[model samples]
Every structure is written in structure tokens, then in C-alpha cells.
Target: MNLKVAMTRSSSPANGLLFALTSAGLYGFNIVYARIASFTGASGSAIVVYRVLLMLVLVGLVAAILRSSLAMEREERGKLLLVGVSSALQGIGYLSSVAFIPVTVAAVVFYTYPIIIVLVSPFVEKTPLTQALVAIVAVATLGVCLVVGPAFSDLDWRGLALAFGASIATAVQFFAAARCTRTGVVAKVFWIQLIILPTAILVSLATGQLAPPSILALAPFAVTMTIAGYVGGFVLQFLALGRISAVAAGILYCAEPVVAAVSSALILNETLAPLQIAGGALVLAAIVANVLLEQRRRLKDAALVPIAD
Candidate 1:
């Protein structure tokens, strides 16, 4: 029994890594689809509204079919609501960035959220500054500067700003969601989508940007977004986290930008400047280093903990 349990534990992280990679692929493809939808005249706000609504309806139906309860405690509901709002902001900012910049550049910029989270942790969680963190920050900053060097002349300033904003919002969403107790993944997603629906709707209405897409265009986009991007991607990430340490999951997530970059090049004929490619490599290295350091810290903490009697 002990050997069997050990084997299972060892295999779980491998499975988790696979799931995380799958999630990254889905998300990368979603970026491409989002760009296409936007080019077809679907505003970011409108796309978000539709995406969340479709996911909510579809996930809710799955829950109903499984006879699963969608109820949540009051605190969970509040946290999920905040997560949903942050996610909506992330979606709007990222999609807007894609409209004005190449998908690969936008993805590289957005992936800087890991570093952003570390920088803001002092204020948000009272984490102390460490030399390792400082070094990682320096490296990441250099990477970002390289990546954005051409943005000043070649890319729209608004797009650059939006990409950074999306990164920050994504960090916030991840942090907020981390605090919540585990719940049914589908149910949790359904609730988040439920909260996002009204927020997106109100934003679209208030801005008078709620230009609905043609049914022909929207039907396919909605199905793809709901099934492949939102549901499949999120579900896989959730499952992966259950089996692997978050540090390992973060490392797997680093593949997302690469996948996006390659897909954009093949599908959209987008090419990155040599400097930008180098910058992307540096950024990815910093992220990988950060995750490794975090994993080490976690192991050290675990070792220091006293075993229960």
C-alpha cells in the first residue's frame, strides 16, 4: 500500500504538467480566435459579455446534468465575484492590446503578470523583499524594456498600456482566487461567469459599445470560446493545480506565450523583431527562475514544519 501510494503521488505531478500544457494550448488558440473576433467588429466588451454568458450557460447546464449543487457560501460568493470582475478587466485589456499590437508581443507583455504579482506582494500580502526576488525583478524589467523598445515607435501606446493593465488585473485575479476554499470547479467557474455577465453588460451598455456580432459570426465564435477556451482551459488548470505544486504549474504556464507566438506567426503571418524575441527569452527565464525559487522556499518551509503527533 505504501509503495502504491508513493507511485501514485509521483505520477500525479506528471499528469498535472500535462494538464497545464493542455490548458496553455487552449488559451493560446483562444488568443488567436479573440483577435479574429475583434477584427470582425466585436468590441472587447461585447466579446467578454458573450464569452462569459455562454460559458455560464454551458457550465451551468453541465452542473445541472450532473446533479451538482451550485450553491456557495457568502464569503466564497464575494471572492468569486471579485475574481470575475478582475478577469473581465483582464479580458478587455488583453483583447484591446491584441487589436493594436501583434499577438506575440501582447502575450509576452501579459505574461509579465508573474513578476507584477511578486512586486506587489509586499503591499498586498506583506511579503518581505528578498535578494532573489530583487534579482528576478531586475531581469524581468530588462526583458520588458527590450520587448517594448519598438512599441514606442511601432506599436500604439494605448495597446502597450492596456497590455500592462491586463497583466496587473490578471495578477489580481489569480491572487484573489487563491484565497478561496476549493469548490466544485465547474460550479466555481459558473459563478464567476455569472458575476462577469452583468459587469460586462453594464460596461458595454454604458459605453454604447454593445454592437452585437452577426449571428453567423457569433455562433461559431461563441461555441469555440465557451468549449475550447473558457471551459476546457480553466478546467484543465484547476485539475492541474490539484495534483502539482503551484510553482510547477507556473512553469508549465510559461509555455502559453510561446504557443501564442508560434500560432500568431503561422496563422497571422506575424513576426517579432530580433530584439523582441531576445526580450521574450529573458522574460521567460526570469519567470522560470522565480518559480524555481518559490518551489525551493516552499520545500524549506515544509521541512521546518513539525509533524503532527
Candidate 2:
């Protein structure tokens, strides 16, 4: 069966929402595993390097089986390179942040990308930025303040900074993706990972952090779970982006941090302060409100279109 047939039911919003939720959930779990990879002995840079290497191999195999070329035209290579660089940066940022803070904290900070996308979309995509959108971004920013402020004493400054940086890189990747032609989603992913793999290796080499990953007090290869999760989450992510608008997919990603919080509590025994939880709630509420308003806006715009006779 085609990968698209398995991942998407159709191009409808509901299908997109399903793909978004599933992709986010996988990513949420991957964050926990990445932290575990750290505890088990893998450095953040090492983890990203290995994950990218493995993902590129697997995605390359898939592309080969599908008879898809992994090469980009010279015209498209610039955007592909940008997307790849942003992906590498985002991966390093998120994994590195987990080394210094609780996985849940990293998640909360990184997920600010949804709001970032909305704020920047007008400039990048020519979407109108209405006053209501401004108000929503304000509310979400306040919520982010609440969420991160209460945990300031416990969170490492480096981790918080890294997580926020990841958010920016993620937004850049999404915008770049929006401009890309939609053909060969899997091929696009393979090429993107190919671009990232070398960058990861070079960074690891320069920092002298280029050790092979090993887990302590477990099966030697257990850390491969982190790499596996990275592979799966990325495959699902590109599929989701192919089927849905970036903003819609981003709004649905409100579930990711929630998934991270809950999983960290259950698996890692990490819990948030009451105030931080409330702030996270406010951020999600703002996202939910945006979802509703966007739906209404789309409906209104649809009604205005002339019906074909």
C-alpha cells in the first residue's frame, strides 16, 4: 500500500486533524525517550546525529522502494537546504534542552511555535492579520509568561533558552515547507534528512561530542528507541503537512505539549507547578479560540465563492 493511503484518509480537514494529532502524540513520546537517551549516556548532539543518520537511511530505502528520486533541482535546492538546516537546529535545540530541564518544561517552551506561526504567517503567507489575531497572540504570550515564569527557579536558563530557540527554528521550517511544491512528500523528507545528517556529524565533530551512543544498565541498543521515534514522528509529520494547512496542523499540535506533560508525569515522574499548569491551559485556550475563528473565517470565505454551473 502507498504510504499516503495509510497515513491519510483523505485531504479533508478531519483527516488532517487526525494526522496532526497522531504526529504530535508520537513527537510527545519521543521527547521523553530523548531525555532517557540523555540519562543513559548519549549526548544531545550525538542523539541528533545518530537519529538523523538512521532516519535518512530508512527514508532513503523507502524512497528507493517507491522509485522516488531523493535529489532536488538546483532551483529547489536552496529551499531544501534551508528546511534541512532549520530541522537540524530544531532537533539539536529540543534534545539539548531536555538535558538541562525536565522533558515537560522543554515541551512547554518548544510548543510556543503554534503562536509564533500565527504571528508570522501574515508576512510569510500573505494571510491577513486581523486585530482579533493580535489579541489572541497577546493572550497566548501572557500564557507563555505564566507557564515559564512559575518554573524559573527550577528550570535551567540554558534549557529555557534552547527550547525557545527550537520554537523559532520550527516556525522557520514550517514556513519554508509551505512554499515547497507538494510532490513526493517522502522524497522531500528523505532529501531534508540527507541535508541534516552531514550538518549533525560536523557539529558533533567540531564540539568533540561525537561519541557513539550507549545506554547504561539496559540492553545496549535500547537507546535506538529514541532514533526510532524520531523516524516515525518525522514520517508522520511530513504526511500531515502534505494533507493539511500548516496553521491547522499547528493548532492541532496543542495536543503535543499536553501529551508531553501527561507522559512525563506517568513515565518520568515529573510534575508541573499549579501555576505553570494553569498558564499552559491558557496557551491552549488561545489556540482553541484561534481554531474556532479560523473555521468560521474559512466558512465565510467559502460561501462567497461563486458556484460552478
Candidate 3:
């Protein structure tokens, strides 16, 4: 059985699904926008800094709206600090990839996280990897190969490494988010962003590549990408996750690459080859299949529960 199947067996499937899909959409568009911003000659470090700054303020407003305490338990704070480090690494990896590769290429590489999640699910989610699940994984992986094959020749090994690094960091993000929920939702989001801003700033300063965006250039992207689209989606996700399971939430995030691919093609004028599109479709289908299988398993388990005497 799939991990996603086990996750939905819990009490909050609807909310979990909603949270996951919303995060995927926000993250998809965030990648496209950030990639476009990177193409404008801003250093990757600089783009990350600016983006984190925006995220900081946005997260702050979210905390205020909820009237939640930003304080963290000492142990939780320690874990959150670690999550911050991973988040910072992910930001740098993603920004670096966008600097050297097409957004679609970067997105494809990062999309490998689903595979990673599946691989790790046995340990964390405690689900057996059935033959059917393995078959699905194989098909999905073949799709990834086909999608990425056209760009293989042009692979910047550095960019590819960064993309993989980002994937690892993203996997960590889901793990940490799930772990941190024992605390409070607002606090988790708060500390993650809180640690992110400082970490990004320090990294940018170390690289000596940080730059202030010109007022004119910052305004449009700020409103369209950062505020209305990216942040809005993220805030919704954070809120929804508080009411749902993180693993189930992570599965729903499967929609991201498709949205990112389409947006990159339309907005950045990046061309999508037929093979790549097919691969992306395969990945999407695999994710959907995984989710459905999990749901079925959960339904079966729930049906087995005995009524009170």
C-alpha cells in the first residue's frame, strides 16, 4: 500500500487533500516567478534574500491574524531551527538551478522528491511497498526519464546537483512540517520563516552577491507573484495542514510540477517538448493513482472497525 493511502485513513482527509493541493499550486507558481526573477540578472543569493524578506513579512501578518503565540518550546525551537537550515539550503539550491537552467528543467529535477518520498515512506509511514506500488513507481520513473531526456544533453551538472539538493531539502520540509504539528501551526510557520530570513541574509552576505531590488522592478512581482499568488497559496496551505496530516498533505502537493511546467511555457516562453509533457503526465497520473490506492485502503480499514455494542 502507498503511504498516501495510509495517511488518508486518519480523520481529516478532506482538509489534508485541500492543504496539499493548495501548497502544490502555490509552490509551482512560486518556482516560475522566482525563476523569471532569476533570469533578470539578479544573483541567486539576492533573489533568495528578497524572496525571504517578502516571506518574512507575509508570515508575520499571518501570525497576527491568527493571534497565535510565536513562542516555541526549547526542544521545538531546536527542531525548527534545523528546519530553517534545510529550508535555506532548499532556497539556495532552487535559486541556483533557476540561474543556470530553464524553470521546467529545474522543476523536473525537483519533482524527483515524490520518488524519494516513496522510498522513505516505508520507514516513516510504516507502509509495506506492495508489488503494485513498485510497478507504479517504475512507470512514474520512466516518465521522468522521458520528460528529462531531451534536456539531458544540456544538463548543467551543477544545476542538476542543486536541483537534487533542493529535492532533498523539500523532503526534509515535509518531514519537519509533520513533526512540528505537535506544537502549533502558527508557531511552526512562524519559526520556519523566522529562521529562513536570517539564514538567507547570512548566506547572501557571505556570497557577497546580494543586491537591493530597484523600487520599480520589485513592485509588480511583489504583488502578483509574492503577495496574491505565492503567499496566498502558502498561507492557505499552512492553515489547512494544521487541520490535516502532513503525509497526506504532501501527497496532494503532486500537482506542482504540472502547473509549473505550464506556467513556464506560457509566461517564460519556454518550449515543452512532447516527451517531457508525456513524462510530466505520467508523474501526475502516478501521484493520483497513489492517492486513490491509499484512499481505498483507508476505506477498507475503516469498514473493518466494529460498531459499539
Best by lDDT: 2
- Ranking under lDDT, best-scoring first? 2, 1, 3
Candidates' lDDT values, in order?
0.68, 0.71, 0.68
Clashing pairs in 3: 5-294
Could you tell me the TM-score of candidate 2?
0.78
Which prediction has more favorable TM-score, 1 or 2?
2
Clashes of 3: 1
**In model 3, where do residues sit more than 4 Å from their true spots?**
1-11, 39-44, 73-75, 97-106, 144-150, 154-157, 213-219, 236-251, 304-309
In terms of lDDT, the poorest run of 10 residues in model 3 is 215-224
Name the lDDT of candidate 1: 0.68
Q: Write down the RMSD of all candidates, one decimal each.
A: 4.5, 4.9, 4.7
Count clashing residue pairs per candidate. 0, 0, 1
Better of 1 and 2 by lDDT: 2
Estimate, for each residue in 155-195, the C-alpha lDDT of model 1 and write its tens digit.
77788889999988887776676555566677678777877
Which residue pairs in candidate 1 collide? none
